[model samples]
Target: MMLSPSDRIHAPVVLLVNPAAGRGRAGRVAQAASEALRAADLAVDVHETRERGDEARIAAEASATGARALAVVGGDGAISHAVRGLLDGEAGGGARVPMAIFAAGTGNDFAKSLVVPVHHVARMARHIAAGNTHVVDVGFVDDVPFVNAAGFGFDVEVLEHMRTPGVLRGTAAYVSTALGALFGYRGFRANMANDSAIMSRKLMTVFANGRCFGGAFRIAPDARLDDGALDCVTIRDISPWARVPLFARAMRGTHLTSPHVSFHRDHHFHLRFDTPPMFETDGELQQAATCDVSVSVRAGALTVIA
Candidate 1:
């Protein structure tokens, strides 16, 4: 259902801005969003994040002050941090606060999954004014929460490559890294189990909470934000040369039909890598680990202004 503008009721909102994100343009974008929300007659408080995980701290403080809503201005990393803070605070007997996003960072993949407009601060602000809240599901991998997707193998390598100095930035960077990794990468062995089945794979695996990643890749086209299940995708071992054509098909979401690719839905799953394998949660690479990782959906766990 589409939300109407009349639904907004001037709730108090705190906007957390990551000044260092998007090549240091997030502060400007945050300012613009704040103005737009205020223009819509909503009370707005803006804060600049100090460092990594600062979004969480600032959001917790705002919720402590009785903020009714919290909006983050940055990429998936910032949003994920803020969501963790909000969720943790609520669990710790703090006030429940609704959240929103003003997409301003590179990729903005999570925001795209929400069907939110990019490069349009006013439209985002209007959504906040509408005040319609929808319950969204979040995915948990071990103790970490990722509102986007989590993956291992090739994707994790690409994420790691992107962190290197002089690596290109934005979606283009992801594309370049993916291409480089496809030819230079070797498959890793993993043991995976979901609610209905267990399997071993020697390639890449992705567990998606949202449909898109790497800007616009519909890696999990059938994924639903409110659905109680996670969309799981696994690409079996294939020659490096074959990966090029498969990747091309993935762009159109037709790769699922390929014999080497497998897709399914599960409410919960556990994964174990044969050796310490690089893993990524919400596009951020985590330390190499030989640990057990589990993913489960917290159904309707988050209230978001949509």
Candidate 2:
């Protein structure tokens, strides 16, 4: 039920702004989004962050104040930071507030997967005003939350390099880094498994809670956000010559049928690598010296405005 203004203790909605997100466009976008929310007749609170971990602090405070919802104004990185804050803040058992993505980031990959009108804060504000809500799954990779997709291998390395400071943003970064990694990097061997079977010599493995990631790569084409199941895709070690066409096909989601590809759905995964594996989630690279990775899904953990 919708609570009246007097019945609500906090502002009806809160916007957590990461100014550095999207390579510095977040500040402007957050301002526009806040204005739009006000125009919607919604009591909106705008909080700007100058450093990392601010989104969570803002969100935790908003939740403590009983805000009706939070609109995260940035890319998946901002959203992920908020997730950490929300989950940690409510560790004592407070109800987690609903969240919406404003999609004002470089890739905005997670927002893209949700078809949330990339980089359009005003329209998203309207959609939230209209009360469109969908609860979607969130993935926990080695205890860190990933709302969109997580992966290891070629893609993760590219993400690591693309995300380096001083590089370009959006798909340009992804494409350039991917080409660089593809031509010079040697594939690695790893082991993967679910409940049924174990596979090794993995070239690339993706555990998806949403369809596309990496600015536009449809790695897990059949994945669904709210399905409560993790979509798994694995590409066994293939020759460097074959990797190019495969990535091209992935853009159109036509790579799933290739003989080198394996697609399935599962609830959990156990991954092991000889050395610390390069890993990425929601397009942010994690410098985790992780030899073993555990991933599982929290169904309907995220309530999003479509």
Candidate 3:
């Protein structure tokens, strides 16, 4: 159903902008979105993150002050941070707050799922004011929360390569880096199990709360944000040459039909790796604290204005 613009929420919202996201695109979005929000007759408070991990602190402080909504002018990485603070803020008693995504970063996959208007800041502000809110699931790996998807193996390698993605941006950056990473990738060995099945030696394992990943790949075609279960897609180890075609098919989510891919829907999955490999939660890379990783979902845990 389409949200009617006549339905309005006049409550004040605090916008947290990540200046470094999308190579400075977030800063621009912050300026435009603030203007649009004020034009809608809504009070707006704006804050800019100066350094790493500032999103969590700023978001916590804002939510503690009883902000009606927290709008993030950045990508999934910043959203991931804001979510942690908004949920765990001591002053809020760990209560959830409604959030808005401005989609001003590379690989805005989470925002894509929300159907956020990325190219039009004015429309996005109006959408926020319309207050067509939806409650969605939030996934966690170990203790880290991710709103879109989290994974290891090949995708992690792509993230590592993304750190210095040269001149490309957005989906092009992801696709180009992944093509380069796929050739040398040796995959990994791990013991993965849930209530129904067990597996080992995989190319990549993704626990998806939303459908798309890496900006372009619909890695989990059947995923639903409000569903209680996470869609787990595990790609078995395949030759480097085989990965090329798999990558192509993943763009339209047609890769699921391939024999090497296995999909499972579950509330939780436990994995143990020979070595603690790097993993990513919402496009932000993290070194695994240990070889064991626990992925689970808290259904309907977040409220967002889509």
Clashing pairs in 1: none
Model 2 is weakest, by summed lDDT over 10 consecutive residues, at 1-10
Candidate 2 segments whose C-alpha is farther than 4 A from its true place:
1-6, 115-118, 163-165, 195-199, 287-290
| RMSD to true structure for each model, in Å | 4.2, 2.9, 4.5
User: What lDDT is obtained when candidate 2 is compared to the true structure?
Assistant: 0.78
1-306 in candidate 1: lDDT tens per residue? 212223224446899898867877787888889889888778888888888889989877655655757889999888888888988877766666778888778888788678655467888788877767788899877767888888878887888788899887788778877988899887877677642224443567888888888765778888888898889988887888999988877777778788888888987887776666667878777765446767678888888887
RMSD in Å for candidate 2, one decimal?
Answer: 2.9
Model 1: residue 8 alpha-carbon error in angstroms = 12
Q: What C-alpha lDDT do the candidate models reach, one value each?
A: 0.78, 0.78, 0.83
lDDT for 258 in candidate 2 is 91
Which 10 consecutive residues of model 3 have the lowest summed lDDT? 1-10
Which one wins by TM-score: 2 or 3?
3
lDDT (C-alpha) at residue 255 in model 2: 91
TM-score of 2: 0.90
Ranking by lDDT: 3, 1, 2
